[model samples]
Target: MIEIQNRAGVERARVTGRVVGNMLQALRTRCRVGTNLLEIDEWARLMILEAGARSCYVDYAPGFGRGPFGHVICTAVNDAVLHGRPRDLRLADGDLLTLDLAVIVDGIAADAAISFIVGAVRDPEDMRMIETTERALAAAIEIAAPGARLGDLSHAIGEVLAGAGYPINLEFGGHGIGSTMHQGPHVANDGRPGRGYRLRPGLLLALEPWVMADTDRLVTDPDDGWTLRSATGCRTAHTEHTIAITETGAEILTLPGR
Candidate 1:
């Protein structure tokens, strides 16, 4: 279902977006060398409770996933990318970590993700992957204005990833988000321009661009039933932001301090 926020709803959405963004920033700062994935999840839980907000992922159970997510945040390290379920593993120096979070405040939901390297080691390939996704995400957002075709956003994202020499994966991408975590208008990472849904004022979309280093294929972890890893075990990166369409242009709701 696609949800359009009214004026009051938009105000609540801004609050939700701010909470999500702040939590993501805090998690990224706390995640360093030797940090446990479980610790990150616990921190997220504490923050959500302290803010009197709700977690969109803790009880999320889609057909694609095994069961209830049963976690407060997604902690993907190195090869892991989307739907990364928190584990007991300790992060090592130079490990690429992806933190995806969603929360609801005052009945509105916002989602966002960030990818960064742990500790002091800087791997060139990892940095390139992270930069590529962030650029792609920005490009997509730049083209996401009211009355703009969804294809325009997709094309912008695809161009960035393709030009960076990374294969685009379509199995999972962005989506419409509001009162619920996930909604209609599946925003693929790669697509033809002038196709799909058209943008309109009051519409909310979560634009995410993710890529694996060597392959577009993905393998789900059997043990946890939530983590999505690269088929080639290559490092991956993801960047996302929740945006709201306004009369003037697209407003990025999931920006920290906004």
Candidate 2:
């Protein structure tokens, strides 16, 4: 369901968004070589609980994923893109990691994701992929204000990814988010500017732009039934943020502590 938040609802969303942002930031800071993926999930769980927030992932049972995600955050490494269930894998010196998280505060939910390299080792390709997704996300946000069509945002993101020479995947993309984790008006990475839903005030959308280095196709991991990997096993990166549409412009709610 698509939800348009009122002033009060927006306030609640802001609070939830901050919680999610802070948790992701903290996790990002503590992540490094030798750190286990499950440990990152545990750290996120503790932070969410400390903030008195509810995890949107743990206990999440969506049709696309195996029931009950049972984790607070997604730890996607290298070839893994979305719905990456935390496991017992440890990070290496140059592992490209992505953390995707969502939480609810005062009944409002916010979602965001970040990708980075572990223990820094000059990998130009990895840095480029990470930077491209972030740029795409920023582009989408720049065009996300009242009167802008959903396609405008998608096209803005798509241009960056496509121009960067990465393949775009449509199976999983951004979505409307407020009061729940996922909602309607699916926002694909690539689209025509004049098509689809129109932007309006108080509508919160999780704008994510992800890409596989070599292919647009994805293959679900057989072991966990949740993780989405590049069909060709190529590297990937994803970036996302929750934004609220407003009267004059768009407000990025998922920014870390001012």
Candidate 3:
């Protein structure tokens, strides 16, 4: 279902987006070597409660995943990418970790993700992967203006990933988000321009661009039934931001710190 927030609803969406962005930033800063995934989840829970917000993932139980996510945040390390269920493992230095979060505030929802190295040792490949996804996300956002077609955004994202020599995966991508966590107008990471749904004012979209280092294939973790890892065990990275379409252009609601 696609939702176009009214003026008042858009105001609420901005609040939710800001909260989501701040929470994710705090989580990123707190994550480091020796940090346990479970601890991170707990931190998320605390932050959400403190903000008087609601988690969109805690009770998520899509067909592919196990019943009830039962966690506050997604902590994907190294090879793990999307839907990363928090575990007991502690992060190690140089481990690439991706934190994906979605939450609702004042009846509006916003989603975002960020990937970064856990500690000091800067692996060139890991940094490159992270940079690639970030650039792709920026490109996609730049093209997400009112009246712009969804394909334009997807094409912009694909150009960055392809130019950076990373394979694009279509299995999962961005989507419309508002009152609910996930909604329609599926935004793929790669697509032909001038196609797909046209953008309009008051529309909200969570634009994410993720890629694996070597291949586009993914393998779901059997134990937890939530973490999605690279089939080739290659390091991966993801970058996302929730945006709202306005009369003139796009407003990036999930940008941290103004």
lDDT scores of the candidates, listed in order: 0.92, 0.92, 0.92
Candidate 3 runs further than 4 Å off: none
**Residue pairs in candidate 1 whose N, alpha carbon or C atoms collide under 3 angstroms:** none
Question: Across residues 53-153, which tens digit of lDDT does each residue of candidate 3 receive?
Answer: 99999889999997899998898998999999998899999899999999999899999999998888577988888998999988888777887999999
Residue pairs in steric clash, candidate 3? none
Model 1 TM-score, 2 decimals:
0.98
In order of appearance, the predictions have TM-scores of: 0.98, 0.98, 0.98
lDDT of 1: 0.92
Candidate 1 structure quality by residue, lDDT tens digits, 1-258: 989888888888889999999889888888879999999999999999998999999899999999999998998999999999998899999899999999998888899999999987577889889999999999988878888988889899999999999999999999999889899989999999999888998899999999999999999999999899999999999999999999878889989876
Global CA lDDT of candidate 2, please? 0.92
* Candidate 2 runs further than 4 Å off: none
How far in Å is the alpha carbon of 198 misplaced in model 3? 0.5
CA RMSD for every model? 0.8, 0.8, 0.8
